[model samples]
Target: MLSIRAVICTLTCLLFSGLALAQATPRAPGLTFLYSLNCTLGASLPVGAGPNGNRVVIPITGGSFKGPRLSGKVLPLGADWGLIDSKNTFSADTRYQLQTDDNAHIFISTSGPAQSDGFIHLRIKFETGSSKYYWLNNVIAVGILTSGNGYVAIDAWQLTSPTKA
Candidate 1:
């Protein structure tokens, strides 16, 4: 009887331990809408294929944006250094500068997967010294890129969770 009681106690402890370990972690917070910037792209200059992928460079021509908290024009000094793989998936590394209507200067970089369905989803980051827009420096942003007529539009969103100070 003593041995049976000990075995039952051990089994109960193990069951409770398993239940505690099985609980899921907390989910990340949702995204908040930030701003959208439309950029025009020049013709693609294909650099041919290699082991990594087929490389191409697309020039950033010029464009403008307007949003709730920020508005700006995309400067012309940037380009998308893109790659195309054997699976036909497209990815882009794009860097550009922006000048706000208030004369604040910002540098932006973005990269992510692009689908042939005419849309590119991007993870975006920004660099700026303007005190008015400094919150952008710390948040993780996501963007959607689509094109029509003569330009591409990027809709940007910010994750709502605050980062550690």
Candidate 2:
């Protein structure tokens, strides 16, 4: 009878543990934050001195995109896009942040010429009335980028997240 009770207790604990992990897991289907050399993107991102924040989620094994849902009319990834020195889709390792309001954000890191700091990536997802915007910020840095050089040099910008359908 004691063994039966123990098994039941263990299973119960396992069930609760799984629930906790699920709640903690990040909402999958990551989104991308695009930065333009020009300000015509028409998207805006407001960075608040977030709460006593300390933890960051650096994606190690996942794609940088969740849903292609975007807004504010995607600036042609061609001559209209400034981030690209030339013209094309550049797949770079980026990062993002989440505010207390539950807005999903993505970021990228960059450094000026001849500097030795990592880059930054900031991704944000927001819905305003009937519009969805994505704000992707990139900070320039030295060698590989990390959470330290992640938060600094944030260049604020926004893109469409997706339609509510």
Q: What TM-score, computed on C-alpha atoms, does each candidate reach?
A: 0.83, 0.21
> What lDDT tens digits, residue by residue, belong to model 1 across residues 77-127?
899988998998889889989999999988999999887677999999999
Superposed Cα deviation of residue 102, candidate 2 (Å): 30
Q: Cα lDDT of all candidates, in order?
A: 0.88, 0.31
What TM value does model 2 have?
0.21
List residue ranges in candidate 2 displaced over 4 A.
Answer: 1-4, 14-27, 32-35, 38-117, 122-165
Location of the lowest summed lDDT over 10 successive residues in candidate 1: 156-165
Error of 2 at 139 (Å): 18
Find the candidate with the highest lDDT and give its number. 1
Query: Considering every candidate listed, which one attains the maximal TM-score?
Result: 1
- Summarize candidate 2's per-residue lDDT along 1-165 as a digit string, tens digits: 479889999999999998998784453342334322211222212222223222222232212222234312212221111122222222232332222123433322323221134343433232233223332222222222223221222333343334443
